[model samples]
Target: MTMMDALGLIENRSYLSSIVAADTALKAANVTLIDLEIIRGGYVTVKLIGDVGAVKAAVEAAKDAAESFGALISAHVIPRMHEETAKLIEKQKGRPAASPEGAKPTAKQEKEETGEQAKTEAVQEESPSPAATERNEENGQEKLTREQLEKLTVVKLRQLVRERKAMESATQINTAKKAELIHSLLEKMEKKE
Candidate 1:
């Protein structure tokens, strides 16, 4: 069999969880980390290559270990990957890998580190351009986008929740949920206005 005949893939929401999974897989069986893909929304997929049996064992070990750290999106072993699959993997390798979720800089952090030029850049990054704005308007008053909501600090989200008298609901939710709820509330408030 060719070297790329057997493969395993594991996906997780947390980078730390992925690392744990990769580590466990290597220790559990004779496998090597072949590729890693970071998809949007903080999802990461780790690929491993080895003999079919080894790949299966590694994937099982990784699945169990990764689940404990965070959400385990998926885990699977492919005994024989198709030619197209190999080409796709090669294509992905050509592109630079994305930074882990936690390592990414926030708009405020960028602004603080850099000066007015950076502050302007941060705002530009958050704001949709004139063309996008026109398109959004044409679509009949688009609500706050997810990217915009993510840019807001947790404190800002909590404050917005309190303002809308949703403190009771927001109190139990995590920071991400708080940001989403606040964004929804602000949209509703705008509609009312």
Candidate 2:
């Protein structure tokens, strides 16, 4: 290969290839006619533009003072390239500085957050509990479904019984009595197991 092939690389502006050539020559000291970059003004220039070590070795080789035995022969060196630079940036919009600083959240804070999450979940149009839809005030009555009745917990049943017993309104006792009987049956079943 002639010096023209090496010079042709400059036309394409291949910065990477020059670094590769420098690394190859520096490491293995591979010397060939193709490795020499013949300049226009009669001096053969070998270019090594990379890290500091690469530039040093390339300069020595180009000056024929490399002392690399016959393995590194002929050329002048020009250093012009540098390695790629690296940078990193981070951005946070909502993160707190220390998150209350090594204190770890209290149990109450955890419970409150859980309770808030539950309230949000409940508000998302999930299946309603009977307590969720209280009796219509104007009518004073609501038709509770069997499924709702079946799903009531013992505490809920006790609360309902207490509410029924405390009713000052005279007209609702018959329905309340029926509810009490069902509640008694539920209590018995719960106790039996």
Candidate 3:
């Protein structure tokens, strides 16, 4: 696998711990910061991409730093991530950060600041709401088809599973593959029927 093919992930219970982890990871190796996502319940996840050895080293360092705060949840290194998984990470990078204090710029705001309002409008038109993508009217009942489930991103599928409380832990949802997420959601849907 190429140097850029590997992916590293580190999740922590607090934003401060995650920031420290990200900082340590960057200083420890030549990895690129993919994104730092602040999930629900104040949990934070830092993603990195680089050579297999570099990513592994970075994650190890990050894990140690995050653990010092007693906030470390999990850390993993994918030596060669699948193309689809890489695409999902890229898609997530395009999304606006959830903070409302203008700490992070939204895509539209970034475009507008750069005098690209037209492009921003185009992006808004192209991206549909999560609800629209996940559900459809089936005999007047709101249901997600298997095809739709497959079309949904892994992150979205994990959110669906979490919302249903089907999984007992966030780590399970985070570590599950796309197919596993789909299967779990499908099983939950069936149980609801």
Candidate 4:
């Protein structure tokens, strides 16, 4: 085997439950990993290959493995095939997006392409999107996104729950295919307060 073949990834998972969840998640994606190394510090890096779908799933599964184990795991999505930006560009058809209608190609012409692909071309021009923050700021009355709920430093989650004057539903989460996001938010409040 070449030197490239010898390098491997290491990961550590949290608990038995997480391990099961992580393993199941990985297996569903058809990634073949040896030396699952489920110990607190064991890691199994599956070499990256296969179609975009399978590779992406394997990477995600490995990440879930770390999250499940509650391990300080670091998984890097190395662009084994080529430079990352190039790989991303390849995701888009090779030719650059056509310029907007009647727009002349000037120094600003390249910058004017506000379509999705242009934004990906260079990261320097990007601005932080406010959609998520705006969604989180609605009088604290609007439903919280998973991330917003996650960020509330426990105490804040409690205050928000008490402030929730209306109850949405209970049976929605427990006996359903999905967990109650709102209920989880309320739980945060109760746990903190």
Best by lDDT: 3
User: Model 2 clash pairs?
Assistant: 62-75
Clash pairs of candidate 4?
A: 11-43, 13-69, 14-69, 14-70, 158-189
Number of the top TM-score candidate:
3
Residue-level lDDT tens digits of model 1 in 1-193: 2435687999999888998899999999999898777889989999998888999999999999998986799999888766566556654676323323467765754654577677778767755454543223433543454565566656655655565554455545344475567666566556544
Model 1 TM-score (2 dp): 0.46
For candidate 4, what is the lDDT?
Answer: 0.44
| TM-score, structure 4 vs. true | 0.27
Off-target runs (Cα >4 Å) in candidate 1 are: 1-4, 95-193
lDDT of 1 at 193: 48
Q: What do the candidate models score in CA lDDT, each in turn?
A: 0.72, 0.40, 0.81, 0.44
Model 1 clash number: 0
**Residue-wise lDDT of candidate 3 within 58-151, one digit each (tens)?**
9999999999999999999988877567767766886433332446776765774576667676656543446764443433334566787776
In order of TM-score, best first, we have: 3, 1, 4, 2
Name the runs in model 3 displaced over 4 angstroms.
1-4, 95-117, 120-193
- Per residue, candidate 4 scores C-alpha lDDT tens digits across 1-193 of 1111111233444445345544654575654333334443444333333344554666666666566557635654433344443333333434443333586765543554565456565442332234553333424535445565554444444444446632345443333222344455645544433
- Give the per-residue lDDT of model 2 (tens digit) for 1-193: 1111111111111223333444445564333322335445333334433444444554444333333322233444323321111100000112122232376866755776788889887655333455755554554534344455555544454455455443333344334555654455445434433
Error of 4 at 81 (Å): 5.2
Ranking by lDDT: 3, 1, 4, 2
